[model samples]
Target: MKCIIGLGNPGKKYDRTRHNVGFMVIDELIQRHQWKLDKSKFKADYTIVQTENEKLMLVKPQTFMNLSGDAVRPLMDYYHIHLENILIIFDDLDLPIGKIRLRQKGGHGGHNGIRSIIEHVGSKDFKRVRIGIGRPDSSLSIIDYVLQTFPKRDTEEVMNSVNKAADACEAWVHKPFPEVMNEYNQ
Candidate 1:
C-alpha cells in the first residue's frame, strides 16, 4: 500500500505556521476526499483510503517535528508499506516561498523531521514533496521564522502552494508519481 506522511508539529499553536505547510496540504487532501484522520497509533493520526484502484494511508505524525521517525517507522512496519510506495511531505527552507520540489530520493538537507525519518527508516530512498517555506531574514532566527504564521502578503501564495501540493498528491492516487512530478514541478 502507498503512504503519504505529512510532517509537522501537531496542535493549535502549529497550525498555519510556515513549518506546517505539510499539514496544510494533507488537510486539503483530507477535505477533498471527505476523510477524517480517524485512527491514532504509532504516535500519529492517520486514515486509510481504499478505492477500486488504490489503497493508501494519510498520516500526520504527532511525535512533533524532530522525532518524526518515532511515528513513521512504526506505521510503515505495521502496514508493510514499501519505501518506494511512500511519499513524505514537508517544508523546505531552501526554495523560495510558494514553490515546491518533488524528488524520488534525497538527504535531509538539515530538516530535523526528514532526518528523523531517514534515521528511523534506514534509507534515503523514498519519494518526497517539499513545500517551500523560504529562508528567514537575517534578523529572524530560523526557529522564530518557522513557527510564525505566514505574513499577510504571503498568505495567498502559501495557500496556493498547499493546494497545488494537494492536487499533486491526489493525482498520485491514480497516476504514477513521476507523471505527477512532471505535471506539478514545472
Candidate 2:
C-alpha cells in the first residue's frame, strides 16, 4: 500500500488560503475518483482507492501543518510503506504561482510541514508534489502571505494548477517518479 498525504491547516477559514492548496488538490482527487475520505484514524482523515497494482490511501493530516509527521509515521509503520512509496503534496512559495514541481527527493526548502515530516520519518527520500503558491512581492510577512486568500483574478490559474497536480499524481501511481517529474515539473 502507498500513502499520499496532503498537507494543510484544517478549518473553513483556511479553505481558500494558499497553504491549503494541498488539501484542495486531494479533495479534487477524491471527488474525481468517487473515493470517500471519511475515515478518521492515524491522526488523519483518509480514504483508500485502488488501481491495478496499488492500493492508495489518500490522507489529509488533521494534526495540522506543523505536526504532520505525527500522523505520517504511524501510518507508515502500520501499513509497511517505505519512504519511497510515500508521496506528499504541499504548497511551495519559492516557485511561481500556479506552477507544479514533482521531485523524487529533496530537502524541505524551509517548509515547516515538510521539515516536521523529515524529522519524524528520519529521511527525505520521499516523493513530493510541490504546488507553487509564489512568494509575495509586497513586504508582508511570509506567514501572513501564505495564510491569506488568493485574489479573484488568480482563481482560474490556481484551479488549473490543481487539476494538473491531480493528473500528475494519477500518473505518478502508474509510472516512475522521474517520468512524472519530467512531464509535470517544467
Candidate 3:
C-alpha cells in the first residue's frame, strides 16, 4: 500500500490559505478520482482507493501543520508502510507562485510540518511534492504571510498549479518516483 499525505492546519479558518496548499491538492485528487475521504483515524481524514496496480491511502493530517508527524508516524506503523512508499504534499514559500517541485528526499528547509514528520519518522528519504506559494512582501511576517488567503487575482494561477500537483500525484501512483519527478519538475 502507498500513502499520500497532505500537510496543513485543520479548521475552516485555514482553508484556502497559502499554508493549506497541501490540503487543496489532496481535495483536487479526491474530487478528480471521485473518491470519498470520510474515514477518520490517526488524527487524519483518509480514504483507501484500490487501483488495478496498487492500494492507495490518501490522508490529510488533522493534527495541524506543526504536529503533523504525530499523525503520520502512527498511521505508517499501523499500516506497515515504509518511508519510500510515502509522498508528502505541501506549500513552499521559497518557490515562485504557480511553480511545483518534486524531491526524493531532503531536510524540512524551515517548514515546521516537514520538520515534525522527519523527526517522528527518523528519516528524510521520503518523497515530497512542493507547491510554490511565493514569498510575501518584505514588510509582512512569515507567519502572517502563510496564513493569508490567496488574492482573487491569483486564484486561477493557484488552481492551475493545484491541478498539476494533483496530476503529478496520480502519476506517482503508477510510475517510479524518479520518473514522476522528471516529468513534473520542469
TM-score of each: 0.98, 0.97, 0.98
Candidate 1 residue runs with Cα over 4 Å from true position = none
lDDT of 1: 0.92
**Lowest lDDT 10-mer window, candidate 2?**
1-10
In candidate 1, what are the lDDT values of residues 38-108, reduced to their tens digit?
A: 99998999999895688989999998899999999999899899898899999999989999989989999
TM-score-wise, the better of 1 and 2 is: 1
What is the C-alpha lDDT profile of model 3 across 1-186, one tens digit per residue? Answer: 999998899999999999999999999989988999989998999998998899999999999799999999999999999999999999999998999999999999999999999999999999999999999878999999999999999899899999999999999999999999999989
Total backbone clashes of model 1? 0
C-alpha local distance difference test of each model? 0.92, 0.90, 0.95
lDDT of 3: 0.95
Angstrom error at residue 54, model 3: 0.5
| Global lDDT of model 2 | 0.90
lDDT of residue 15 for candidate 3: 96
Q: Write the per-residue lDDT of candidate 2 for residues 113-161, one digit (tens) a residue.
A: 9999999999999999999899999989999999999999889989999
